[model samples]
Target: MNANGPVTAPPTTGPPEHPARAEIDAEENLLEKRRRLVLRRLKQFLGMAVAGTLLLLLNDLLLVHSSAAPSLVVTLGVFFTALCLSYQGRARASLILLITGVLATVGVVLWLEQGIRDSAAVMAMTFPVVVSAMAGSRPLFFTTTALAALVLMAVALGDITGLHPHHVRPVRLSALISLEVVMLAVGASIALIARDLRHALHDAYQQAASAREARRQMEALAFLDPLTGLPNRAAMAQHFEREAARASRDQRRLGVFFLDLDNFKTVNDSLGHPAGDALLRQVAEALLSVVRKGDVVSRIGGDEFMVLVPDLQSDLDVPALADKLVKRLTQPFHVDGASVTATCSLGIALYPDDGHDFAELVKRADTAMYHAKNAGRNALRLFNEDMNSNVVEHLHLLNGMRQALEHGRFELHYQPQINIRNGDIVGCEALLRWREPGLGLIPPSRFIPAAEKSGLIVEIGTWVLQEACRQIKRWDDAGLPGITVAVNLSSVQFKRGDIEQVILNALDSARLTANRLELELTESLLIEDSERFSGLLKRLNELGLTFSIDDFGTGYSNLGYLNRFDVDRLKIDRSFVHDICTDTHHQTIVRAVVQIAGSLGMAVIAEGVEDQATADKLLELGCELGQGWLWSPALAADDYAAYVRQQGRAAPA
Candidate 1:
């Protein structure tokens, strides 16, 4: 019920009509037409009955001078009275009375009237045949015509025998016979016309029924998946809106379950698309069977199904229901005479919890389903706040990083590398940094993950290389001693076949020598695709460019690559150097790295050498290069240039 009394259904727009409903509608229309026809005929009969009764009473009391007047009068009055009575309830009964009245009037006129030839009585007796035709009944028309024929025969016998005063000579009898023949022809015509009318009505009814059924089929095809007979994604979206509204009104939880079939591609690959389609249909049926009455299971697209549970008693109910579905869907199904088993990964999101709207809920549920697949197939997971937070933050970072690239929000800091023997300045490593306007100085750690995840690292890393080379050229032109500037390369950038082109463009644009610019890479980058990495390194090395493995001892320390490739130096990871003076493990690893560098004809640079003791230990261990807070932390470009000039003045030229 709505705010009004009983709720009324909205009028149907068109098609997809239920077969039973269509039949009921057609029957109701037929019944209504019949009711109206019956009522019309009954009124017409009542008018004829009233008028005939008055005309009979007047003729018997004044006009007619016959011995049968009273009998005819009584019969007409009785017949009229019966018609009026039957008209109150039964229309068919009133029609019967009218037919009987015509027969009775003809019989009375012929038997009682004397010497009545060419009288109006014969014409009046034909009224029943006309009335029967008007009533659209072939049975009544034929019955009245037969009865009238018998009456004519009786009148002809009466005239010949003089049993009544009415008699006809042969010449007048011929005219009367002609009149009977014309009336019979007219009755036959009316019967034939009525039969044709009935056939036309039936044909029209059948056509209307067929058209309605075709419309219903078209509507079903639009919203339903033809193969599986399940509501499609479009229909599911509509269902979600309606169910969400209802859940909001009742303050109930609505659970959206996103299900994806596992190993379905294997079926398509091995058996054929026909078998895969059959498997999808079986899965749809299984899901439909397990859901409650109010729940809707829809085939979203290809091997994926969405179930919307509109009302739940508690949030806890979602897991048990999901488990039941997973168990049921995992059972073996027969397709193309072969038994196959498939599993589903399900992710659930609740109304007013995971999301308040349809799209959000679907996305979250899809994400959770992906997590379930990652965890292992044939499992279920519910969306949690942690997932939402992480996804939202990642999205924010990706957007911000794009904006930062276009607007010149990035900065580069250079850390000076020094010689452990003479404390002489050699070269500095350029590091990329970002300082968002409002957020202020976002470290590389904060934004690098976003860049890497979005594949923006390639573009950003290219910019870093170009800027680092350009800075090195500016410092060299400023009367500072020529120093090699090392720029770190992201694994994504290093793997591209165009890396050498990007490097040459940067060096040419900055007007710097290849040896003065070194490319730094991590051990993992080399280990990922070593053959490709080695070929790329060889090509760049042939161009007079230098290469170093950055943050060594932290990743796969494959020493064989150092011997196979033309590498110059190793920047020891800060993890070992930060505690080198105190941790014995750090001392031992540093000694091993220095020995390996000697064996491979490479120089070793100790990074994060923060104290005099760590520096002294590196020099004693035959590692001649180092950089840390002990010398100076990484500084802005201009500040590093000032530090470089000061260091040059301090050195013994």
Candidate 2:
């Protein structure tokens, strides 16, 4: 393994919350608290008023002469009116009425009775202060307390100055002064306690607000992707649950689309990770723009996104929506001043039809996504029952491959690459084949793709390279003519495996010279990171090892890389050679490849030549090298050695 350090995702901060909304919520809470307090106080005042009215009526009936009857009647009227106002939801009006009525009644009773010496005077002075405190108004509390103190002092001064001559008992100055001191002391103490309680209440509200904000932020971080600022997988699951309930209730359909970008790794490798991150952000924004307002787009992880579309009227709507998404994403994005183009493979699974649960639907959709990628990217596929069987088979194949590798069930077969003019074996391509105990002679097509997808190709490719080198040395030691052995390299091995080190170690262990080994690479690999690959290819070339582009015309056919890299040979794909004698297009393609190879000082080899006519046509096109069934099919190591020996005796020296 290459064993490079892990790449960490960049850090992102949570979005800022709206301050105005928080302030509004806090204000509403305070108002609700004050309303409840006022209502409770009003009920208490109403109860006391009913009891006092009955007592006053009894007193009026018992007394021979009573001067307080009018004041008592007025107090009863004011209390009833305040009750009616409070019941009508006019809390402020009711509180104002109660305060005014209390002050007027207390002033009249003080004048009519024993002035400051009356016990009613003390109740009158403190009632407004208590009510103001309950109302949670600091200014009103202090103002009411000041007015109560002034009334007490005024009454004391009046009694001392003999302003009221109708007193039943003469009041003493020491007693009046003591009463004034006691009332002031009590009022000041109430004010201090109310002030402390208000401060504590304000602090408590602030702390609660802070706690709420913190919890909100934590929820955001838990459910959001930091890089794309979209909903993450956890959020998608929660959203699915909610949407599933709604869809079930309404008898509607829900669509789950699994989307993955194609060739995203090339961007990360060539342009750097920052550009890749920028491209992902642009992709997220574009998906958001194309989806409906109610639809959800979530970033599952790294270049893979899942979209949830609910309230679908019909299953037919999915294809149209998928096309729209594909068209939007396929457009070029400008990242880091480079115009980059990307395509997506989308897989769709519908609720109630594909599966009822989220996990099952996602799995099916993911399977479909791989199908779309396999067919060719920038396309969409719908989940089917047949795909499920394929998934099960794939799992079995992966397990079997692992067991096969561990138990040495894998072996290489060498196919001779023939010289067209001389009819002699020059080199052979090593092809891997698996022969399980139950399933004998498993083809490369069956397991190679699985291995590549599962990342087992790197280990498998390592084994192939080592074995080919050792086999070549054995052939040399056996006194056979020295012929090079070519091994195909998977892109996975080139990128993730320490290929150079593995090759060097294999050569050293086998005692094989570098020139006897040939590496066959795909065209896509050469153009991925040309600069880095150029340096690596140059180093490998300096060691006398050679490279050939395998299946050349099937992939990226840019001629620039032919000159840029240290490529020695071009292997024309079998598709062109299969019908070369009959198809004019195939002949033209082969002829062009031959000319290009000759111009670049490279060799051309046509694969899949089946008969004499095809081989003769290839020779006319100036391609002197060939390999196919016309020569010999791929054989085991021992069979290949015998075949080479037989061909050697047949060749004219």
What TM-score, over all chains together, does every model reach? 0.46, 0.54
Estimate, for each residue in 580-624, the C-alpha lDDT of model 1 and write its tens digit.
777888889999999999988899998888889889988887888
For residues 1-653, write the lDDT of model 2, one tens digit per residue: 01111123457568766889977987999778757766865656555554554455455546423566688688778878888888888877887777666667767767776776676456645766676676677887787778777777776777788775437555544335434543553455456556658976887898889889988998988988878878889999999999999999999878899999997899989999989998988888878877766789889999999999988874335654665687688789999899988889988787867888999999988998999899778767778745344534554465567567779999999999888998977788999999999679999998787677656688789999998988887877886648788899998898878899999999999987888899999999988889988998899999999999999899989789998988999999999998888999999999999999999999999989899999999999999999999989999989988998877733211
Runs of candidate 2 exceeding 4 Å displacement: 1-198, 210-387, 649-653
lDDT of candidates 1 onward, in order: 0.76, 0.79
Q: Give the total clashing residue pairs for model 1.
A: 4
TM-score, candidate 1, is 0.46
Residue pairs clashing in model 1 are 16-216, 114-166, 115-165, 115-166
Error of 1 at 209 (Å): 26
The residue pairs in collision within model 2 are none
Query: What's the lDDT of the predicted structure labeled candidate 1?
Result: 0.76
Maximum-TM-score candidate: 2
